[model samples]
Target: MGYDIMKNNNTKRLAVSLLLIFPLLVFGQKRVEAKADRLFQKRAYALAADEYEDLLKHNWNTAYAHKQLAFCYFETREFDKALPHLQEVLGNDDLPLRYIWEYALLLKAEGKIEESEKWLAYSKMIKLKNPLIPRLSQDSTWHPVALLERQEYKVEPVSFNSKYSDFGARIYNDTLYFTSSRKTPENNSNYSWYDEPYLDLYYIPLSSLDQTPKALEGGIRSKYHESSPTFFKDYKGKNSVFFTRNNLKSGQYVVGKKRINNLKIYKGEQKKNGTWDMSRDLAINSPDYSNAHPF
Candidate 1:
């Protein structure tokens, strides 16, 4: 009888030992995860991801783990893994805001329109303290999304012979001013791109039409890359022109103002008098990202 009791006691002790060992195994996985996090902080995303995979084998808080793992995947351009993590976060709304936008954009890029829109709705709930979030509509990252909403925009096909690609249109006082890329006669055959006469501005006049709008040209011009144009209507009823000029030497674009009587179009150019004093770049524009489009 005593022998039987000793055998039973041994069996019970073995079971308890296995239970304690199992938890330690789980805790040991965290060491691998910690190493991965360190690698991620150092921007060694690929190595971090490898360690994360080992940690994932232990099934450690998969939802959050996958989300973080996905970020590393994204940083390394391993988009496939990043996607599932993003999907997980999308299904769970409590995700951090920074990750929400990242995931939404990734979904949008993948052509998952419905899903992306759903996430974007949630992203809108996270308001930044700075006033710039609303202003992001004008940013390039949002441009494609903004284009999606303009489904009802009237399309007009207008083309010109000059190489002028960046275009903005403004209508004022029965006239139109626009920038174009055309070389001047004085410019060399191997012309400096900026100094060429073709780099000047051009415009057209709008005359009476019963219904149709017609664009007619005025000959006056500027000599630089005068690209974006905006009309500022002051409170006192006086309107002024604001535009950007690309400096040839510095390779920097600047914004400036000019007084125009006819509202005629002018392409930017360095005048014979070197009066580039009329332009400067606005502070609102990011130096890294161009603010070329005018609305």
Candidate 2:
């Protein structure tokens, strides 16, 4: 009886151990998925695809695995292999906006023009919330995927510091606010390894007919490393300028807020003494997840 009881207790312990191990295994798979996502962001599409495929091999997070794999294939222009994965993503009700444009482009490439159009329409209906759509549309290669009939988008080549990486644009009061990593003594010198200078916000006024732009504030440059600058003019009377700073906390994460003399994003208005007051941090941004390339 004692031997039988001991054997039964051993079996119960083994079952419990397996149950605990299962969750840990699931968490490990999620970490792999996150790493794959980061690899994709860094433009290492081939490596990301391999990691995504590895996650799928374990039958873990199949939906997301397929979706990310499709992105990798699409990036490398392996459209033939991308179709089934894209199809699986679309078949699910919780389809992410991340790959809608790519999927549409793939459909069009495969001679499924009508289906591609439908996906494009659907993407537009949702306002293409993935934040990657505008960047993709701006690329000459992916313009056809946007499905916009107009050959010309009425866009003029607005120039800035030629070295700025990942420039963002916003139109307000017929003016454009953009970011550029030109050169500076403080933040600019930090780019010793990389040739590009630190990024800062700049703006230009618009003309009436041709829509040409000239520098605002007499080409006044900010004193901070500002990139991804945007001007928000909402339905209300709130007119504010915003930008993201890389050097805020060691140059990886970005924070958004009202423009001060510095690159930090905070909420405040210029006081009568010419100093900012009531400054606050943007609640939406995360420390771990730097909001690079805002829409």
Candidate 3:
């Protein structure tokens, strides 16, 4: 009887200890979550990702937290890290169509072709939050992919690619120009959305493909993105290049009605010494929207 009394006393002590700690655990979780939410609202995605990841590592799994984590990773372009969190929130009835579209694209990007197709089909069956996305996707693809099979050229990966965003390639006059976000010590300005440097134009002469690609020799590289280069002749029959850059006003970053810095086409006349003139945002550009890819 005495031993049983002691055993019951020990159980009571353990329960009392848990009761004392439970509120602290709850408070800690709340504090972390609040910090993460504030950072997310401020659009500090990388910092929010760190906080949410810490919360999850401690096993505080909530659909809201998981969804937020996914958004944080997605915004920071950390798609591989985002995929698991995205999968966690897949069952949420109120989930947006963009996340579903992202999951489909992420799966496809990771080589899970069948799984991506399945999610895409499932996205169709559900009550889509953005039904117009499907229509837009279809409408946007027709012109780009229509001649895919007709083209007989073998695609080759360029040698100068860094483990960063490299795209919007065009070849003109035996030089291949493309946009890249590759890191360089002299270039420190970064895109506001993430940690990487802003995109800049680079070129590799076809005759010297084995050599390191050089930055476009001019004062054309901006603190913002400079992309999509195409060489052509101006109305005056002078050599010129068209490129896409952010809508800057008075040398300051300007956000449009959507609170986003939109891209616009800029024409630069090639001077006798190969340097470009100051930016001339084309007449076709409107500050309210993005206008790019001048062919």
Whole-model Cα lDDT per candidate?
0.54, 0.60, 0.78
Model 2, which residues run further than 4 Å from truth?
Answer: 1-7, 91-98, 121-295
What order do candidates take by TM-score, descending?
3, 1, 2
Tens digits of per-residue lDDT for model 2, 1-295: 9999999999999999999999999899989989888877766677788888989899988988898888778766567878889988886667767677778776666656678778767887766566555454444255554444335567555444353453576776776666655554434543321235655554566554344233223112334345554555435545544445542543244333422123344333334443323234477654444444445
The TM-score values for the models, in the order shown, are 0.42, 0.40, 0.72
TM-score between candidate 2 and the true structure: 0.40
Name the best candidate (by TM-score): 3
Candidate 3 C-alpha RMSD relative to the actual structure = 5.2
Tens digits of per-residue lDDT for model 1 on 170-279? 76667565655554453223212122243344455555323322222121223434555565554554444455544332443333342111111222223345222343
Which one wins by TM-score: 1 or 2? 1
Q: Which stretches in model 3 have alpha-carbon errors above 4 Å? A: 1-48, 58-61, 72-78, 104-155
Give candidate 1's root-mean-square deviation (CA, Å).
15.8
Please tell me which predicted candidate would have the highest lDDT against the true structure.
Answer: 3
Against the correct fold, how does model 1 do in TM-score?
A: 0.42
